[model samples]
Target: MDLRAGLSQQQSLKLSMTQELSQAIALLQYSAIELVDFLENKALENPLLHIKSRKAEVYQPKAKGQSQKSNDKAWIEQISDQRFTLADHLFPQIQDMKMSPFQKRVVTHYIYHLDDNGYFTGNLQDIANHFNFSLADAEECLAILQRVEPAGIGARTLRECLLLQLNRQEVKNELAERIVSEHFSMFAEKKWKQLSKLLSIDIKEIQQVFDYILTLNPKPGAAFHYERASYVIPDVMVVQEGDQFVVRLFDHILPKIQFNKDYFASLNSYQDKKVNDFLNEKQQDYHWIIRSLEQRQKTILNVTGKIVDKQQAYFEKGPTFLKPMTMKEISEELGIHESTVSRAVREKYVQTPFGTVELKSFFTNAIESVSDESLSSSKVKMAMEKLIKEENKQKPLSDLDIVQLLKENDGIVVSRRTVAKYRDQLGIPSSSKRKRYD
Candidate 1:
């Protein structure tokens, strides 16, 4: 109960993280590309470090009908003609339309405001103010822009986008137009029973109309973008080797870093203590970085190897077989801290037989089945998708029906609510929306 401060010798053991250790921990989280960039920068800064550049393997083209020069010429021509973009697509159409110069200017301004999805994201009032024109004039320009090939273009809301498309159809869908205009909230929420009562139409008919709505392009400008397809570079590759899967780190892709022996040897003969101390500090930093990088690689290999082992079924049978896994489970199995496992997998990609997938995607929450076996949420989602795809269109299954089907067929007993959650996750609508009238 004594509160007075007293001088006393105390003995205790505590762990403290050094700056080098902190840097090592941070390096573990960096992706393959990031690590390469980091090493390249470090090599430039440190005089004692040298990164060996990979020798470009000379391409030995096989004897074919066309020469390599001809192939190069054709590739150059192909790239030159591939500069078409959303703006390029719309500008020609704008040029063809017969309008006053002022009208054309207004239309062009509206076009500039259109988002990647072809929706007009800017305020009409803002456009009006910029042009020093009435809001009505801006609206008129937007209306004319909506008349472009993509009917949903220049729409502010999803309701407007659908209605615009429906209006432009040669044979208009009156039911879809009404649903989008009036019951958009209900349509979005998939309140099929309420919609049925409100429209006084059969649930089946509403679903048929919904199916038509699905056919219309939601993101009209997505395909017209000039953006090149991005490719993922996987840090690790998992190859099936007979009964076991082999996890190999892509070390060849990264530049090999080593100490410059000549530079290190020359630094030892320097007379200036300050300069020598600075060089020594740099050398120590270089050594720590190299060690950290090696440790990072080992941690990654161990974590990914364990992950591949746990998700072996996923590699063999596809995404449906993705078993329930967690960082804690992996940490316990690998004899590492949960945070260490997390950092090792963060922003990392692993190339499998199927495709390149993020390492973090391997860990998913478990859902208990009736058989007392755990199912990954991803697995349940796949099961839900399969059921929806194979269900009778004329009488689409409800969430409750899916719950029962999973229990009966897959031996997975999930709640109706859980089925609904999984269904939503798959971007699937309700039973009423999925039903086919004809």
Candidate 2:
């Protein structure tokens, strides 16, 4: 055997994590909505950050004894001023429970350590070590807090969070409570048949319990603060200006931001090391905020531009002309990652002349039929809904019957199951539910 080695050809690209250029490229791929949010959050967390808005400029005139201009810069401030940390709420409850001061202190520390979702990310041992308390004592405090008004608060696991909530609810029977506590996994997975057999209950009864379970607040601490609210300030506003479409960001109420030049200028004269350091840090923060805002604007423009380019037909002809689209396709065309496209669409909405719509709603995967023509799942679903709406309620169509009608009458050759899925997606109640009385 020959001992000589052969070389193989390979090419690679290097990426730097710390460089702002790389970060900006990463931000570009983010949907306009995501980029704005990410930048706004960064600005809020950093004291040195500033945003320049036309609203701010108008406000300057008002400060000089003038009227408020409609085009004033809307300074994007923190959502809320009240600082309601989890520790503030939980520690008070622990104190009121008549626990020892040591236990209360331990509980306070634990609450501070919890994540936004109210889960203890750190292990119990690490928590105990941080406060010099035994693991058992730390756990006991956690247990008490878990049972508080927000039942899921301070839960270490999802199971515990759910069970705590279930305990507080008026279940009215042992069976419902047991099913929720012990068979939650089965219930969630929609293994209705299995649950019925295991619990020795009828299928309809099991389904009723399932419906009740679904109504519980999964994240009890979700509404703890205004900051945690799911808010999306649209990047692009598509309004009908006569016969054409116009696009702009909806930044009406945000504040205008600028550097405190007087403070910055004062920093130059100061000889104190700490003051200079603070000014320098603030200066860098200001730069990041300004750059992030600019990047957000550009990113939104780029995404909206692409969306308009690809979906021109839909804009002109309405939803029926919406082409098949996917995150992967958009990512490939834009030369970015799929996750970035997903993030851009996630929680981001577009205010069109027709109505306010989530950006992702414009994109739907197509299902090709035997005739070699492709139709969007959304379009198919719409067609199915139309058929159902026009169908005779006295003799409502079955899933298979709908499938045949779609193929023979509407030229959409989809399976019965596909019809069923589309029906469910459209929230078109089944034949049983749609039955009418004389």
Candidate 3:
């Protein structure tokens, strides 16, 4: 029972993170776009930071008819085409509907509750209570909302969404409607045997009905929210020269940052200690940030260079040649932590001879081959995809059949369950679902 406190000397190893180290870690994780945005913000905050602008050389055509003004006008028109959002598409239709003020208000509230997928998320009872309206009125308003341009705009569930679309078909499909309404769970699960027995319909007819159901738009509002196609901006470009691949970074894509020399020089003349201290602190921050940026670029280049070197077979041949690799392996080789390697590759893209690919895509789990050598899971998946593509639609290959095919052709040894898992990962339907009666 030692109740008295006594001072004792002890030695222990302690790890601490400095502000600059923390900043470096954070900067390393930032994607190219994010890094640019961060630097822009920092430039605004630090008066001593300046971003150098690299102006592109504009070419003027000396031809007879072409004019710079016309090009400028065309460019303006291209960007000016407004994107129609789901709300924008539906609001105008709502205004055109002839409804009493109270009804319109209730309908608008319901519309607000509709999610991006055009499914109602709010409780009808809660909405009715909030609006001081009867449940009957709310239901009527809901029906009216559903009748808008998109057939399944206000559905509560997937079944309801499909049923709404089914009801709008030119040819009445009573069987499809019944399947959607009553046996939706069974239909979704693809229990063709049970469905055929229950409905007293042949498997062929059931297939036809299922095929028709597939044509219906599950997310009706998705069409209205037009998404502009985004193009990938590769952070690194690999160019093949003789026997070696030269790695080039898209440094020009990022803003060139430099210290504001004139501003720094002006600060030296300041008499106030506080002013000098503030400038000095800001200068240190500016320098540290610059060094971090440089380090980030260097790390990315080094990591990507190693990846390119290792995945040379993939670059020379195709995706099928991609070897199994992990972050741990790269981290060990580079003498860095696994997390650091992960950060370096995250959201990064590399432009190769084949195409621009995500850096993360290069790393995949290894599958054991017949020769006891490890094979990339991606390569196996690619092989599986090829087999499925060439498969007879009438008799789609089962997971067991795929495993056999891989063993015979590719000399790969994988379980049926693994094949099934890979197929699922590839978004391929089961054999029963994929089978065609024709």
Top lDDT: which candidate number?
3
Query: How accurate locally is residue 415 in candidate 3, as Cα lDDT from 0 to 100?
Result: 97
What lDDT tens digits, residue by residue, belong to model 3 across residues 132-181?
Answer: 87888788889888988789999999999989898998899998899889
Question: How high is each candidate's TM-score?
Answer: 0.85, 0.53, 0.87
Name the regions of candidate 3 deviating beyond 4 angstroms: 1-14, 53-77, 87-98, 371-373, 392-395, 436-438
- Kindly state the number of residue pairs that clash in model 3: 0
Tell me the spans in candidate 1 whose CA falls farther than 4 Å from its real position.
1-5, 52-60, 63-81, 172-179, 187-208, 240-244, 261-269, 308-322, 365-375, 436-438
- Candidate 2, residues 35-114: lDDT per residue as tens digits? 54665676676555555533323233335554455325434442346777666666667767867877767666667767
**Model 1: per-residue lDDT, tens digit, 268-348?**
778989888978898899889878888988999999989887887899989878889999999999899999998998888
Q: Could you give the candidate ranking by TM-score, starting with the highest?
A: 3, 1, 2
Clashes of each: 0, 12, 0
Cα-based RMSD of the predictions, in order?
3.5, 10.4, 3.4
The deviation in Å at residue 317 for candidate 3 is: 2.5
Which is better, 2 or 3, measured by lDDT? 3
Measured by TM-score, how close is model 2 to the native structure? 0.53
Worst 10 residues of 1 by lDDT: 73-82
